[model samples]
Target: MRGYQEDTPPSSISGDEIAGMDDEEAVFLGYLDEMDELVDDNMEEVTDQEEEDTDMEPPEDLSILVFNKHVGSVFCCDLHPSGKLAVTGGEDDKAFVWSVQTGQIVFECTGHKDSVIFVGFSFDGAYLATADMSGLIKVWKCNLDENQQEPWPIAFEYEAEDLTFGLWHFGARVLICGAVSGDIYVFKIPSGDIKVLQGHNTRVECAKMFKDGVRLVAGYDDGAVKVWDLKTNAVLQQIQANVHDMRVTAIDTHPENNIMASISSDGKVILATSSNGKVVGQLQAENDLETVAFAQDPQLGFFALGTLNGDVGIWDTARQMVRHQCTKSDDESVVGVTKMIWEKDHLITGCLDGAIRVYQGRSGEKVLQLTGHRSEVLDLCFNENENVILTTSDDGTARIYKYEINKDKD
Candidate 1:
């Protein structure tokens, strides 16, 4: 077996000081002991605007502030493709579906035996999937009757030990995941049929669906990326090209082309063709890279890469040069970037410091900075069609924000 083990820090806890502890101890001490101060710090500081409105009311700065739901830190969040609903999963072992406008809990998912590590929405928004650290996945019908009761009935269930990441096909018919045992599992919707594709020797860090959903691009903790064919459950290509020196952190597929972009913990980005696993371009960075994203609009012709030292770079894909870069100011402390997304002419990023910052896509200038979480920001999603953003953090909260256009400025 490849020697690499899956050691990325859990979203429920943060800090390199406690990185050596087992999962159980880390979750307990990090959330219980470390967060005792956080609960007080987060609860006591109310803005003057909030005080004027009411002690318990949400301040005017946010569209919705969800509270009193998760007892532990939130680990992940996703928006429905329809953009009207959102789901969040966390250390509380519960997942919640809520309205974007009202913040009312539409349904509560309560069957997990451990922390819900990831929550995802189907591409068509017809189904919602939640997976826990215990390697259990539960799927729920998203279009259930509005009056449906809590503890939503599961439409499908699958068990695989140490499931790390999951995503749906473009048609929302098949669910795929990577496991710590280096196995890939694909379960078809409504049907219980299961297929296993085995190739990677170490823990799988990330996976992406490409080639009209007939192929999967998987990255492993051993710094290997392989493409698998869904039809025959066979390995289509093994990349013999430039490989990451460290664990592969993230992967993003091109919206129009057959290229896939990936980043490693060693601060390098590689653009490779999906068909043959041939390296097309590589961008080297001065800091360790953590996450990456490709611009959906073909005309943009650029990709975004985020680093451990609070740096964001927009590299021109054609020219293979850094077109723009954004870094923390002198007054701001450096924090690792955890996730990134590209929207209309803007870049949205989540950081280890529990802050979300928006920068201009072309100029790399700071457009907006938001802070509310008491710990690291774990995951985030943006729906351009609805102009809404959802962020989940270790502070045990998921927030919804809308991008407002200033009509007066135009």
Candidate 2:
């Protein structure tokens, strides 16, 4: 057996030494120094605050209901159609269906061997689907008969290549999932009938269904966007790969128009016709885009884009210009947005800084900021009426917030 020997520690490189290095090496050293300083500053701030408020309690106004059953980071969450219940999945490989009003677990979805990355309710609240990172998917029948004594029975289950995202059809029991194997799987619930939509050997990063319910638009990691005819499992149209230089972060379609908008981490936004995938308009951003959402009303003629640098822009689709630059709250740190939705004339966003913020879509003003989680918000969703907002976070809790527009701000 060979004897183990400890390697000598490297001497610290000085600023002068870094300056004399090549451009790439000097830049790398500078990034390291900046990161070190940032860590030191955050540590100092946290230590000081801990010492100052050792016995303080958090305010009760943070959330209306908090679901703390998850043992690890909650990765995904969805609100029930009735707005009375919610389903959340977490890193602990479990999913919980809980009451929103009282924060009581209604169903505990178990038997997963990996982190549950996605959980959603079917359109009519008839079924709940939970998908894990290892491609295990389970669908449980909801709203069971009151006389039944057993737990909710599993309606459907399947295994596929590692899953990236999953979504339920708006009007049907169909469920669609994207996989790392560059395939989109559509499963009709209970029956487990499968339809495979083949992709161009690249991971499907995100997808959205057209309002017509027959067409689906999918964005790929290699910067391709394809519109698929779900009925035939054929590609109806596709945008060229050169349109975006990097992975598509998010995508949304206009409610009334035949237009689809997709944003990339490379700071590019492409607006294309969903019918033909023709490139109609494009916008460039200064920072990497994280999320995108279109106004529900076609008359608004605008969409919102959230960036990784903590900036939000409301773009006028017709005029191809920024209409309003929404600002964050003054007290918030520069934690980027992770998800967003447009409800009526307002935009609700979930941030990495563990805050749910509401902005006025018409005037681009920050209206509300709700906080509770101590870590990043991973996912969020709202009810049909937009009155109940549910968010899951890395803090191992899911929070429910009641939302109401402040007419006084108008």
Candidate 3:
């Protein structure tokens, strides 16, 4: 309505003029521009909040370097616990293990026949798992020593036919993968024993370990969320029959509590108990959601949600309301937030705008913005101790950035 030409009416023009003056079709053409304006107006408010929001120490930029070994878009990446190593998998059907400091390729995994969609390191940093779009998963034993260029040999492999997601267990002894057919495969390391979790009616979109690795939480395309007992290899409870009006897009469990947060394509985030599958709280956004994550510190266990329309929200799960909307001060065009994580009092977001932004947790004041990727970032991993992050992008590169944090502050 704001951009419509209200002075010209349909009756004021001749037939030929009417065809050329049809403003209704022209109104639809400006939809994206309207969104850009609205988001820009929203984020403009954050500049005001910056006046009073000093809870977070300002972030410092240490480095921004790119890895260009992959010939195709990098789909996934993971940082080891030690913060010294990183792994990335990409569309080129190859996975690369690299040093986070120098961005040097440590080892190249080149056996997958299709695009590698997921790559993760075990909690102990002793193993790495790489999975392709075709459901072939390979586990490698990271043999890094003083050389740092040591070969990582393939220890085992599994095929699930339609792999969607995968991760290493907390102990680094279990490998779990979700399939397009709505089944989950749990592989015991070294032993090669497997357990299959079946309950979801369609594809499994996301899955996470909970209860100190005793249980697993999974979300599906049909909007169902389930918690499984890993020891028994059975679903323990159904967290939600319809967590969202549409497919579940992402999920994140609490750092210390038994609750987990789930988001769907319909723009809703639900916080529920993992043990009994009870709904505790919910938050809604104007745009469909892309990802959600909980902060690691239990005392400040706020959660963050990223939307498809490029908005970011920091919610107080205990209060059941958003504390800050990062885009409320939009000074530029918005882009979808594809990945996000919360560390202490800060939130790190990987945006489809091909930029990585760090915001103060409580006020949503952007502290730092890192730009290097030529396309949307597909994955992100942060190492709090080292103040480093590894990000993979659709532009066929994995990048490493070092953030300088104020250690003197509490």
Task: Give lDDT: candidate 1, residue 147.
Answer: 72
Pairs of colliding residues, candidate 1:
267-289
Clash totals in order: 1, 0, 10
In TM-score terms, which candidate is top?
A: 2
What are the clashing pairs of model 3? Answer: 42-328, 42-329, 42-330, 43-328, 43-329, 43-330, 44-329, 44-330, 45-329, 46-329
Model 1, 196-229: lDDT tens digits are: 9885468898988774768888888877888888
- The 0-to-1 C-alpha lDDT of every candidate, in the order given, reads 0.78, 0.86, 0.81
Candidate 3 has an lDDT of 0.81
What is the clash count of model 1?
A: 1
TM-score: which is higher, 2 or 3? 2
Cα distance off (Å), candidate 3, residue 204: 0.7
Model 3 worst lDDT run, 10 consecutive residues: 54-63
Identify the runs in model 1 with alpha carbons over 4 angstroms from their true place.
Answer: 1-63, 328-334, 404-410
Per-model TM against the reference:
0.79, 0.85, 0.81
- Per-residue lDDT over 8-37 for candidate 2, one digit per residue giving the tens place of the 0 to 100 score: 666588767866799998788779789979
Q: List where candidate 2 sits over 4 angstroms from the true fold.
A: 1-61, 144-149, 328-334, 384-386, 405-410
Best-fitting candidate, scored by lDDT: 2
